[model samples]
Target: MLPDALRSRLALARRSLLPCRGCLGPVGEGAEAGLCGRCWGGLLPLPEGRCPRCALVHAEADCPEATAWDCGDALWDYHGGRPPLGALLLPGIKQGEAGWRKALLGRVLRGPLPDWAAEVDCVTAAPSAWPHRLLRGFDLSAEAARLVAGRLDRPFTPLLAKGWLRGRQASRTESQRRRLPKRAIGLRRGAAPRGLILLVDDVWTTGTTLLRCAQALRAGGADEVRVLTLFRAL
Candidate 1:
């Protein structure tokens, strides 16, 4: 255990390191996490007038199959910026940054929550590879779920687990992504999270991961599943 004086000094150092929570930018007096105003403005709420199911723009008429298994509701289209909206998430998922994680969570709160997320009895996250988690010292998806659940005042869960480890998905093409084994995700034995489950993750790419996550939830006795991602790949 750390000595009291040393622990207190370390705590003060950590407090000094955290940025304002609002903007994920710079520190300010009395600011929550050193977030500055300009970075705060970068957060984009989920736009109005999107398909209820997939959150894609559809004819004013809803997609005929909107109700099938539910789909993703994202905050921003991924094409506006050169690297796109979800760019921040890719690095954080592959790398690690507490500040980026906090900003991503803040983005989720600013967006429209899918009915499933709003009504889900509990929230869970897609599990990262154990080796990756060990290297990072934290699971990005779980961190995202915790932040989101805190914002929504709902329960957060870390029940899901990866069934197989795989290479990073960031550089892989959609076709390459499809080739990933079906057993990439699974639920822990006898630890199902029932009811509507809100699955949280940093990014939605090719939709395969989210779909697989939904399947895992369903297998775990989840009656329904909805996704809340920081950004969607265009």
Candidate 2:
């Protein structure tokens, strides 16, 4: 039998060769996310009933962590839509599928910054551990933050750094995630955060990472912090 890792790679390889999920048109050779440019350009808006602050779908519009930041919003439901773009693409991006970055960025660029995002004087991102960055060959949150900065006409600042020994959030349970040490993430040396800040991340799963980075920014001297994530996990 094929190993699980090899099986997943074979599946992704096959999926890459299929026609675009949206239009059933032939995708480019070696396409990632199984979508053509036109189809990718046509991704729809996120479904409704999300917390305006946290971006997660909840019974109440305001999630318990809604108040953790000055304000925040996300682009799409992590597990929504027929293609489930978030579910389909993010894992690949996180695992170093650099080719998928362009497709994902195109989708995110379609969602303009909210009115509140205009007030952000500076843009920054939640830190991915240096090891993960090395393994993945890119950091989605950081790259997306750069795109957001360009869209906002703001400067992207490297605000926080993750401790070398910290664990990956994806591998942890909810309780362990909530108990993440304060030292796991913190202000970057020589960084002087100021005015209103926008904290960017790839996905908002538990809201723990964004909240922690916001706290770091505020504690480091930012007057206020707002967050914008690409997708919100259910």
Candidate 3:
């Protein structure tokens, strides 16, 4: 039998020759050649008509509640029609697939950022509950935050700390999520930085957790707080 390292290398080589994950089609040449042209075209962009404050898609005839954070943007909308690249990679990321995580981070780094993001003075992440982090063997939000900080040339700091596991937000309904209190997340004492702050997370479902983190940052003296996520459940 082939040695494990050789087998792994062979597998990687085979995968490199296969169709791209997004469109299951041939990957054409270029900087983005690893991803097929069709799939690259399919990748969703943040809607231009979203709410200015929360980045929620809004119609001309409708208005959303006042958001707690200053402003936010997401790489893709997570609901309706076919799943986007972020959704396709989420399961692997949750299962601690290093390659998938790296791909997701790269996508985030190359994706568009809100105009105000340029003014962000520092970067941070919404804290993952310790229990969840232990189960996954990685902190998804922290990893994304670190990569985003690197791309932005800003400091990545652990500004918020999860006090306890309030149970998985994914398992809860919208009403249940709305009932979750602001205290579910707390700001790390003395860790909050002055000036504009950018908070990163892997996904946005109910917006409860991000709101709590933003509130904590505000309490800790952040001049402004903004959120950026890989995907937002619509």
* Per-model CA lDDT versus the true structure: 0.67, 0.79, 0.76
Cα error, candidate 3, residue 169 (Å): 1.0
Q: Write the per-residue lDDT of candidate 3 for residues 1-234, one digit (tens) a residue.
A: 999999999987776688776666656653153555454444576676788667776665544654567588887776422436656667757876776676657777787777787789999999988888888888878988888888888999998988665777778888998988778888777684678999898788768888888888888898889999878876
In order of appearance, the predictions have TM-scores of: 0.71, 0.81, 0.81
Worst 10 residues of 1 by lDDT: 80-89
Model 1, span 1-234: residue lDDT tens: 999999999987886677644334455553333444444444455557776667666675756532326666766655433223355445744666676666556666565665556676788887787877888887767877887788778899777777544776666787898887768777876677788788877666667777787887887788988887766654
Q: On TM-score, who's better, 1 or 3?
A: 3
What TM-score does model 3 achieve against the real structure? 0.81
- Model 1 ranges off by over 4 Å: 1-40, 59-68, 80-85, 106-116
Error of 2 at 182 (Å): 1.1
Candidate 3 yields a Cα-based lDDT of 0.76
